[model samples]
Target: EAGVAQSPRYKIIEKRQSVAFWCNPISGHATLYWYQQILGQGPKLLIQFQNNGVVDDSQLPKDRFSAERLKGVDSTLKIQPAKLEDSAVYLCASSSVIGGEQFFGPGTRLTVL
Candidate 1:
């Protein structure tokens, strides 16, 4: 089966700017997640969606980051007024269900200047 797809692979932006990233999860999967991985740290869950409903988003910086899975397939994450601390690898992952092993995309690495 085809794996997850992400775009741009990398991004460079100034602090307090705005940026967005896209993700396409595996077909037939029901759970999707977004994670932020800073250098030397493990991926931290930012948000989760089960179909079109949000399952978890406690870790997301709501003041700057927002995401949506419109059709329960593809999704997008946006950060407005991005800060220097926001520079990190944004990973998109998907699983068949809760507690299942997640498959990750290559991720979009952001650099804040």
Candidate 2:
């Protein structure tokens, strides 16, 4: 099976700007996740989705971050008024079942200036 796909492998934006990242999970996956990994730190889950509905988003920054899965296939994450603290690698992952082994995308590296 093909791996998860993500776009804009790298991005640079000024503080207070806006940016978006895209992800397409494996064809048959039922669960999707978004994670943020700062340099020298492990990835932190930002959100999870089951089909087109959000499963968890408590860790997501509601004031500046948002995400959505469309029809349970492709997902998008957006950050507005970006801050220096937001600079990190945003990873997308998917699994066939909850708590199952996950496949991850290459990730989009965001650099906030």
Candidate 3:
């Protein structure tokens, strides 16, 4: 089975700038998630989607970050007016079902200047 896919393995942006990242989950998976991982901290769940519907987004910074999983397959995450604190790894993951182990993609590492 093919693994998850992500683009532009790294990104550099200035504070207040805007950026977006893309993700392609495993075929036939039903749950997808976006997580932010800082330099030393564990991955923090940002948003979750069960198919094209949002399941959880409590930790997503609505003021700056937004995401969507159209057609319940590929997804995109965007951040407008980025901040220095946003410098971190944006990881995309997917699972075959709820409560299942997730397969991760090589994240897009963002460096805010």
Tens digits of per-residue lDDT for model 2 on 1-113? 78999999999999999999999999999999999999999999999999999999999999999998878999999999899999999999999988899999999999999
Q: Per-model C-alpha lDDT, please? A: 0.94, 0.97, 0.97
Residue 58 accuracy (lDDT) in model 1: 96
lDDT of 3 by residue, 1-107 (tens): 99999987999999999999999999999999999999999999999999999999999999999999989999999999999999999999999999999999999
For candidate 2, the C-alpha RMSD (Å) to the true structure equals 0.6
Instruction: List the candidate numbers ranked by TM-score, top first.
Output: 3, 2, 1
- The candidate 2 region of ten consecutive residues with least summed lDDT is 66-75
**Candidate 1 Cα RMSD after full superposition onto the native fold (Å):** 0.7
RMSD of model 3, in Å?
Answer: 0.6
Please give the RMSD to the true structure for each candidate, in Å. 0.7, 0.6, 0.6
Tell me how far the alpha carbon of residue 9 in candidate 1 is from the true structure, in angstroms, after superposition: 0.4
Predicted structure 3: clash tally = 0
Which 10 successive residues of model 1 have the least lDDT summed? 92-101
lDDT by residue for model 1 over 24-56, one digit each (tens)?
999988999999999999999999999989999
Per-prediction TM-score, please? 0.97, 0.98, 0.98
